[model samples]
Target: MSELMKIQENLRETARKLLANGEASLVIGYALGSEVSRVVPAFISREDEVDRLVWNPLCINNLAKYLLDYRHEPGKVAVVVKGCDSRAIIRLLQDNQITREKVIILGIPCPGLINPDLVAARLDPGAQITVAAVSKQDFSLQTGEGTFTFTRDEALLKKCRDCEQHTPVIADFMLGEEIPPNDPGDPFVAVKTLEELPVEERSAYWDKQFSRCLRCYACRNVCPACTCRECVFDQAEPCWVAKANNLPENTAFHLIRAFHVAGRCVDCGECERVCPVNIPLSLLNRKILKDMKDLFNVPTPGTSLEELPPLGAFTKSDPDEFM
Candidate 1:
């Protein structure tokens, strides 16, 4: 069998053992959602539920976010994670949110995930994905008319396409082939391009995009890092920013949101993933990440628990100069 099949078998076997022996209360993995959606996340509570789990293109809804929600629960939980998901786990561990001891990590070596929206935009929206194949550089889907192909670069999640860390930084029960080293390509080109534009033109560009924001806060709500018990924006008495759809408030909301995740944003790109209006939220995040990298040689919040994030941990000689 191919590596993918072998990995799937191993995942199923491991998940079954955990659920059967009551080692885990639930095993979070990908399962079929319905006719339209390719693969949705499944919570496998019983050994019998093992058959339901399957991995595929649209298994992109992050499972790391589930750890925060599940950490409060009683027993251990088993969750599948790709390279990116594991990085989020590292961030979680760094923040002391979830103890590494409480959960089992089933790390999958990801080739890449497909963007159904991107595919559908090119083909008929109603066209069904009969069979989808993937390789390091290509993604092909069989439609009713003819099989269509696109480069993996074109089909991948904007954040994932440029992901340097393709291996889970941490995992107990890792499956699949060894991950290759991260490519040395800058994924923050959009952010840099925006920075290159004249201040007036840049303002106008963002003014148009931010103006379209409906103050829905979908981006904030879905963010793994924004998991505060009582968010400042939700608070009525000293509202951090006004809860209006005006450009100023909307822009502030986004800016503040991005700033909150500054050094810590794993560039998971989920913020951009679920936006109703396609705002390249990751661009904001990538800019902050780049700045943090420049300011402090630290690229990410250290995966270890003792280190405090930049928001709380202030250094004496921090640069405040504006070049």
Candidate 2:
């Protein structure tokens, strides 16, 4: 069997068994979408639905975030995961939100996922397009114009371009071609340049950037970790920040959102993807992430559930920045 087929077949067999045994109510994984290059998450509730599951480069949505639905009953589920996704699952376990055994994981070595939307915008601006495949630095896409090749750097999600993990850190049943582990280094060169700027320059820089906020709060709403029953943004009695679209409030809103995620964010880059204004909010989170590593020497909170939340834990050597 071709390696790809073997990976897909292996996962389907697992899904079929899980469904047949009633071990899970759903198997959340990507399926071919109606779009030319679309991959949609399938909530497979039956063995027959296993046919729709697919493994490919275009499967970019972080399905782990969907588990935040408040009404989901207590039962096991199956989820497909990549390297970074393992960290997300670990974080959920650390919080005692989801038990380790509740979900069957199909871990796969993640090379990287290309950002289709970014490609569409840079070239066609408003054209409909789908990524057919990505082989290292080149991405093939079917656009309104025709099929084309684009450099991966131009189309890759910023976080993915700097991704430090290529192999699944945790898995019950892994699929796809095995790849070597990626270097776990400070990959935030661009963010570091921004941080090196003077405080006044940084303030002025984000002023123009955050000014574009529409107060849509799509970032917070789509986040899996922001699963509070009632978000602080909606609370107006105490008025933590104004509901208006002013720059000050917008800055506070973005800052607070990043601060809240400090060590907990899994760096799925969902907040950046969901933002309509095209803000690079992940930079803020990465700043804190660097501090979490340098100052506390802690693995970013969600990287593993064995450790407590960085802010939730205290030690003698902790940095005085938060003090």
Candidate 3:
């Protein structure tokens, strides 16, 4: 069997046992989307429904935030998490958004995921994916048409290509074999490249990107760091930001958000993934991440629950130039 199918089978068995044994009332996972190349979040409450769960390179949604919907609900919630999604779980835990007792973490060691858009571009949209496999070097799909393969460079999601964690940092139950994390070179290389640009060029680049903002707030909605019940952008009493779509308002919104998640962003790349205009939101977040690292000598957010976010904690030795 292909590696993807093997993982899917294991996931189904695990979820089935959780539901059947009353260990969990719900299992949040990925299900086959309308298109074979796409996958959508699945909530399984019955043992039979566990079969709906699947694992593959295209299973990209961060399932961690869905736990909030059930945090107040009765029974334990079992959530499937990739390495990136696992970080969001830690974020929620550290924020006290959800209790560990109510959560059952099903962790998956992701090699990387294939870009579904790239897969759709190459295959028939309606094609049924009979089998799928992924590795460090390439991803392959089997369909009635035949076997199709793409080199990692050509098809891997950029976020996956730059990912630092393959095995989840925490798991109540690990669903797949441990996959060692790949060395993605310097994580700050792109940030450094952007920093080296002229001041005028840097400003112009961001202005051009932010100018196309629809303010749909997909980035904010999908962001795991955006756990606020009533976000500042939506408040009318304080009227912190107007509802306008102009470049100035949009730039203000983006800057305000970048700072809001300054030390807490796990660099999951969901903000960039969900942005319709293709704004490099991850790059913007990473710039702050780099600065936080340089100034605070801190590790990536959500990697550990023991370490507090740099901005959230105060220390005597913290840089004080701003004061």
Best by lDDT: 3
Q: TM-score order of candidates, best first? A: 3, 1, 2
lDDT-based ranking: 3, 1, 2
Q: Give lDDT tens digits, candidate 2, residues 1-323.
A: 43445667778888999889998778888887665455687788899989788775667777776665522667787888877777777766666667677777778777677665655455554444432455667766555778677687676656576675666667788777777765746667868999899999999989998999898988887675676777888998889998888999999998988888887887777788778998888888888888778777887566665677778777776767756
Clashing pairs in 2: none
- Each prediction's whole-model lDDT (CA): 0.76, 0.75, 0.90
Worst 10 residues of 3 by lDDT: 128-137
lDDT of 1 by residue, 1-323 (tens): 54555777788899999888888888999876554335678898988879777765667877887888799889998889887777777777777788888889888877777777776567665665555566777877666878788888778866577766566667788877867856747766777898999999998987888899877888877677877778877888897788767989888888888777877777777888888998878777888887877777665553434556666577876665863
- What's the residue-level lDDT of 285 in candidate 3? 98
What is the Å distance of residue 106 in model 3 from its true position?
A: 0.5
Clashes of 3: 0
Whole-model lDDT, model 1: 0.76
Candidate 3's C-alpha lDDT? 0.90
Error of 1 at 219 (Å): 1.2
- Please list the residue runs of candidate 1 whose C-alpha ends up more than 4 Å from where it truly belongs after superposition: 118-133, 140-150, 302-308, 311-323
Model 1 weakest 10-residue run by lDDT = 299-308
Worst 10 residues of 2 by lDDT: 125-134
The better-scoring model by lDDT among 1 and 3 is 3
Backbone clash pairs in model 2 (N, Cα, C under 3 Å; residues 3+ apart or in different chains), count: 0
**Per-residue CA lDDT of candidate 3, range 1-323, in tens?**
86668878888999999999999999999998999789999999998788788888888999898898999989999999999889999999988999999999999999899888888888888887878898667899888899899899888898887888888988999888888877888988889999999999999999999999999999998888999999999999899999988999999999999999999999899989888889999899999999999999998999988888888888899999999
Spell out the clash pairs found in candidate 3: none
